[model samples]
Target chain A: MAQFMDVHHGMKGITADQLREAHQADLAIEKDEGVHFEKAWADPESGTVYCLSEAPSAEAVQRIHERAGHRADEVVPVPLTV
Target chain B: MAQFMDVHHGMKGITADQLREAHQADLAIEKDEGVHFEKAWADPESGTVYCLSEAPSAEAVQRIHERAGHRADEVVPVPLTV
Candidate 1:
């Protein structure tokens, strides 16, 4: 499974709690897509939401996000860690 | 509290488990700086490590990362969420 970090813009003024809720909702439906939504972070002031996940492809990540009602602006594969 | 996302480059070929350990180590000492290391993500293929934190300023975030021995390449304040 490849790791990915997808970005969402224009989410300013939202709260971390709310973002968590949305993330959970997405997770509820993600298993069907073979994706695992690992973690999420948001800056309410910047309206930025980032989600990290493992999937077969970035398209799978985007498809899940779009189905869950928050499409990402960018879905970049993360090939390294530490 | 302001949220920030910091990125570390050249971390390729590392594992998620290792990143988590480093993040935990940083958390153990982060309280002294008043910065909360919330979550982390890494891409072994891309050599990218990203950290999400809550702090008074971006400088605080950088300071904490520097202290943790993984200086960030970029620390950008996220002023909004969704």
Candidate 2:
């Protein structure tokens, strides 16, 4: 599977706890989609979230987010060094 | 060239202007390295910068950051859809 970084913006009003809840809720669906969410970071002030995952395609990553009720602002493919 | 998103953290003390200056400095070396920096976003509060670019390898992306005196916290390869 290829790696992808899905960046989410427009989360300015969200609290850290709320963001963590949303993230955990979304992560539950990963197993069904063949996507491995490696890690994630949330910017409390900007309300932006960055998730690092390994998946088959960018669309696959978006689908997971969509299913979780969040839209990915941008999904960028990550190339492996080796 | 493959797309990559280099995520940088640990800028809690950096100002928006200072971050912008650092980003501009790094972008200047991109052309010489055969890297294209498409876009970037900075969070002043957290001092995190996310850069989207197209390059041949993760190492090439890191080399640009290294040359500019900033270390990339993570370099993830982005796969193109078409």
Measured by DockQ, the strongest candidate is: 1
Cα miss at A18, model 1 (Å)?
2.9
Q: Write one digit per residue (lDDT tens) for candidate 1, span A56-82.
A: 999999999999888999887876444
For model 1, chain A alone compared with the true chain A gives a TM-score of 0.95
Name the best candidate (by TM-score).
Answer: 1
Per-residue CA lDDT of candidate 2, range B1-82, in tens?
Answer: 9877778888666665666677788778988889887766554444567777789988999999889998899876644221
**What TM-score between 0 and 1 does chain B of candidate 1 receive?**
0.94
Q: In angstroms, how far off is B66's CA in candidate 1?
A: 7.4
Give a tens-digit lDDT track for model 2, residues A1-82: 9877678878776665676777776789987789887766655555667777889888989988899898799886644221
Error of 2 at B81 (Å): 28
**Candidate 2: residue A21 Cα off by (Å):** 1.2
Overall lDDT per candidate, in order of appearance: 0.81, 0.74
lDDT of 1 by residue, B1-82 (tens): 8888888889878786788778977898888889998777776776777887889899888887888888899787875444
Please tell me what DockQ candidate 1 reaches: 0.31
